[model samples]
Target: MHSINIHNKSGHDQTFEVHGWANNQNITVKAGQTSKIPAPDGSSGAIIALHEGHEGEQVEITKNGYGGNDFFDVSNIVGAGGNITAMQVGDQSTLKGDPHFMQDMNAAWHKASQDTRNKLKGFVFTNGQGKVTRIGPIKDSPELEKLVRTFANGKAYVGVGAWNGNPGNPDDNAQSSAGHGNKDILITYNDGDASPDLASPKRESRVAAFEVQRVQVAAAPPAPPANGPGIILTNKSKQECTYFFYGNYWNGNGTAGANFDKPMKNVTLAAGAKSHIPLPTTFKGRVQRGTELPATWVEFQISASNDGAAHGDISLEQGCDGAATIASTDGTNRKNGFANDVLKDAPAAACAKKPNGTKAIATTVGNWAAGPNQAAIDYLKKVVGQKKAYIVGGTGTDDVASKNKCLAVDMY
Candidate 1:
């Protein structure tokens, strides 16, 4: 049986302890808001004591100050044998007048038994001005013999894979050398020539059962559409359409010439005139319409006027109007020539056009495809009767056509 779960997504109020180095056994998780622990037949490394900010502060891994930010889970221990033995015990008042942790003399404190060497040797803390720190006599120290030559000689560890540092407090745009919020001490075996010396303070070795996982930090993705869904092109055609070129004009001759182009600057609406085109507020697939290629929608070619010299060559079925040029790539070639029963009361999922198999709904303006400008011939001249033209190369015609203004017609 092995279990440990403590999730306090932080809002303050947290205190924990779960030590267990090779069965010394421990469990103390109390801080209202969340905590749990269970380990019956497993444990070799686990020490996560924190008090870094309020709650008796005083624990600084290095650099800044203010302690209490911890995480040590030896992922299930076992490693330390090339020459293991270290002892420094604690409580010269949480030691560290220049000390770094070391304990393990002669196969476990010399087979203990002097009252378990005076109640299992020392280590007591409470500093940051509140006083009270300790570290015992495992070897008449001289400042731990020059900090045991600043340790660097191998096999003597204390667990949590011989833990290391980076315990919070970096501010100013996060920088513990750039590992972010940081906490990752993972090592598995061949622990030779360790370091941080001090004889046997390999993070105070104790391993048997290990697995500690708590990672919460991810939330940012929601901002697009600041202004892009307005389109209304009504022109009820009286005979005039040009203002094309937004994309897809390969008229460079391939696939039998007239590849596509028309509709562009002729200016002659006298019958209904209306324009308000603005469709690319982002997030649809591939935009960049000033085009040299990048385009997922937008293409409106017109013909009924030669003054513009047939713009890009005009041909998507002789420049849209009486409909029939549908080569589609799914966006139903932009709902061909609209006027779907004049939107009889609208609504059919708000009609993005395309489906006139009878719910008589059809709408879509700026995002192109109703073909041949003047907002698709003024929506086929305000529709009063017989209308259904389908252009892109012909197929469904009975005369009168025009439609395109879908994104629910925002035009603003």
Candidate 2:
């Protein structure tokens, strides 16, 4: 049999005799009181007696009264002494005081885990002074014996140390050096995995949580002030007339407009004709008149005639007589001569040949379909470059017949 004697510093003193073998037995003392238990000499067993419950009893103890603290002192009275394995005083009392054994163990574990996660990798849970706590992987415990064996075979082992008051400071003299001291454990991976070496427990938890986001960059639009020069032509003439306008651009190499052939319709002025002719929106699919063309020197020419026919015998030709000439030089208006001649002879070279592989030949001459002529088709095919052609006509012998005639000769 085993016994324990408890002396209260401020209250009563009592004794208890624990017979036979008892495990996890609880003994309690009242508030501000003390109790004791006696053990048979030469007996061996474990005893746990707090200041709240009796032998073989289990109860939750709470602190009461101000300046009222209880004390418990356990001593083994048996030779080959029965052990006084555990003693819990103020274990979980509500009074403002230091944490209990369990809480200390938990705190140690939390500190260890945080330190390991930040400074080291691959830590596991182990039993601390009272409960499961975080530490280096346990290789010696039965549950981890296999892992330990494996690590040993691989010349790797994880060492453990008793909890120090400061988990981060592994070198603190406050640590229990009797059991396992502060040391690192080398854990070997079963499948060639590497273990991480951690710094001292006193290290800060460096593992941080972060957020990631994606940002998009938008492209800026073109500036409007940088756009190029523009030209607007207004026809203020009476009597239906056909006008042809031409211009030469400074393409960095030299003047390059003699190759373009743009024909305007026979605008019927009807005494006072007024029409605006804007330059082509784009040149060669790139050079926009108002977006790319600079205000550099350029030559312009305009040709006008009262004859309604696009190309035929002209009884009289107005607006443009003599020959094509320059209307403007070096961004300045030049002396106006036979302006129509200047328009006609703006360029001495003939217009570049249409890229179409074939040319139209007048098959017959008579009242024909009133649709686009071969010239229009060739022009459209050369300029617009449509692979197929379609002709629409109104009800009339001359109109319907003109469709086929137009297809034979160059007529719009």
TM-score, predicted candidate 2 vs. hidden true structure: 0.16
Please give, for residues 1-412, the per-residue lDDT of candidate 2 as tens digits.
2223232222333223333223434443443343444432222233322222323111111111000111111111111000111222221111111112223323444555454434423333334453433323242333332232232211211122112211222221111111011111111111111111121232132112211111111122212311122222222223343444333211111112121223222222332343333333222101111111010011221211111101101100001111211122112222221122222222222111112311222111001111112443233223222111111111110100110001011101
| lDDT on C-alpha atoms for all candidate structures | 0.24, 0.21
Cα lDDT tens digits for candidate 1, 1-412: 3333433333344453334432534333332233434423212234333343211111112100001111111111121111111112211111121121222222233343566444533422223762323222212333322232234112221212111221211120011110111122211111122121222233331211111111111122222323233233434535553323232212111111111222222222333555544543221111111111111122222211211100111111222222212211112222223432334443344333222222212222111122123332344334421123322221223321121212211000
Q: What is the Cα-based lDDT of residue 322 in candidate 1?
A: 23
Worst 10 residues of 1 by lDDT: 172-181
TM-score of each: 0.16, 0.16
